[model samples]
Target: MVRQERAIRTRRAVVEAAAAVFAERGYTAATIAEILERAGVTKGALYFHFDSKEALARGVINAQISDDYWVPRELKLQEWVDIGMTLAHRIPKEVILLAGIRLSADIQGRSLFGSAWPAWTQLVTDKLVEAKARGEVLPHVTPRETAECFLGAWIGTQFMSEVVSDWTDLNDRISVLYNHVLPAIATPAALIRLDTAPDRGARVVEEVERQQRESPVPTEA
Candidate 1:
């Protein structure tokens, strides 16, 4: 059990180090030596988890999205908004996510590891589908189209935020984005109830963590 836990930690460290390098330097420019040094792990350890740089890059790309189990909200749109807000709040602090987004956007890198956009679109579509079913979204809103368009805008917003403020104001920019976009998609009642505060992401993340902590752990009978 201990060995498994240590191996998990080591693999995570290697992935994080690689992500940091990829985020700072484009995928092609980054080197295994640098990742090794950054991770402070032996070459063997890295190779054990990932045989090549491509594999490491793929690992980071796959690891970027938050599969966090959030407590479901009464309003599905709120949960959908939380998805964006939490990402905006967390991305700046997470090099893995930053690297993944950068790598996914890199035109040159696209052939090697495809963009994460489709996966993200699907994720958003699923949530929006739920929201629509609940009548939280407008009748005219097509969940897939809305999700794709919103993702395109969100990607652009991320790029602009990173360039302008190195991501310091990402949450604020995302809040602004939600404010503009949600009004059109969400029902008037839903739109008025939704929270688009810049700090909303942080709060949402905290709520998830708090829920996790408070949730009862199952014990063997």
Candidate 2:
């Protein structure tokens, strides 16, 4: 049991190190030697744990999105918005990596679409669909279309946020969605007060960060 636990720790360290390296240098420029040095592990260990760099990159993204869990199937639209804002707060680095990947030529959408994107879209679509069904959203609103627009804007905003290091006003973005964007699709009454929701959501988001920090998960190893 102790040996297994140590192996898990080492693998987590590798993913984190690789993620940091990739975020700073990008995928094409990042090398296995850099990842090894960052991880402070022997080359053999990294090779044993991951067959290649591509697998390691995928692992990094999986850690970011699902944390290896199945996606949530049910939520109100407001809840979905809360989750996005909170995730950005907790794992800004990982979110940046995703943005970097999308912009990078080395990685393709198909590599992650079945595993990650569908799960994300499903979560967004489910909430939008539920909100429309519940009359929280206007009947004319197309859940799929709204989901795409919301997700595109959210991802784009995260990327732009990265380019500007000093600006950390995700709440402002949420406010725009609530007051302007979402209202255009749904009723104003359906809009959530993010200032209030973040208070509760912050706790949940912190718990997620704590879990990822304290209990390291096994990766390729």
Candidate 3:
């Protein structure tokens, strides 16, 4: 158990180090030596987890989608909003996420390792499908189509935010995105109940943490 936990930690550290380097330098320019130095892990250890820089980039991309800080809500639309807002909040703070964004956008890297956009689109599609099933969305709204359009808008927003404000205004941009887009696809009731505030991400994270703390731990019978 201890060995497994240690391996997990090591792998996480390697991925984080790679992310930092990739975020600072484009995937083509990032070096394994820099990542190794940042991680303070031996070559063998890094190779054990990630055989190459491409693999490390893939790991960072995979880590971009997680439900660790997500909490269920009465409104599925609200949950979808939370996912975007929380990611907006986290992107500036997390190296892995930032790296994922950079790698996904890199023209050369896209050909080599593919992009994270497909996975993100799928996630949104699944959520929107659930929301449609619950009658939170308009009947004519197709989840996959909506997801693709939203993902395109999201990538454009990120790029604009990066260029215009160096990503300091990303949360606000995402909030505006939700405000404008949700009204078109969501039911009136769901739209009214959804929170797309710029600070909604921070609040949702706090709520998730509180729920986690208040929940009872399960024990084996």
Residue 11 of candidate 2: its Cα lDDT? 89
| Candidate 2: tens digits of C-alpha lDDT, residues 164-189 | 75326654554455445666776656
Number of clashes found in candidate 3: 0
lDDT of each: 0.89, 0.63, 0.89
TM-score per prediction, in order, is 0.91, 0.72, 0.93
The TM-score that candidate 1 achieves is 0.91
Worst 10 residues of 2 by lDDT: 66-75
Q: Tell how far residue 158 is off in model 3, in angstroms.
A: 1.6
On residues 1-221, what C-alpha lDDT tens digit does candidate 1 reach at each position?
A: 67887899999999999999998888999999999999999999999999988888889988977678454888998888888999998898889899999888888887877778888999899999999888898989889999999999999999999899989999999999999999888988898788889999999888778877899566333
Residue-pair clashes per candidate? 0, 0, 0
Of models 1 and 3, which has the larger TM-score?
Answer: 3
**Model 1: residue 85 alpha-carbon error in angstroms:** 0.7
Model 3: per-residue Cα lDDT over 1-221, one tens digit each: 67887889999999999999999988988999999999999999999999988899889988877778777899878888988999888888898888998898888788777888999888889999999999999999999999999999998998899899988999999999998899899998888788899999989888777887899456333
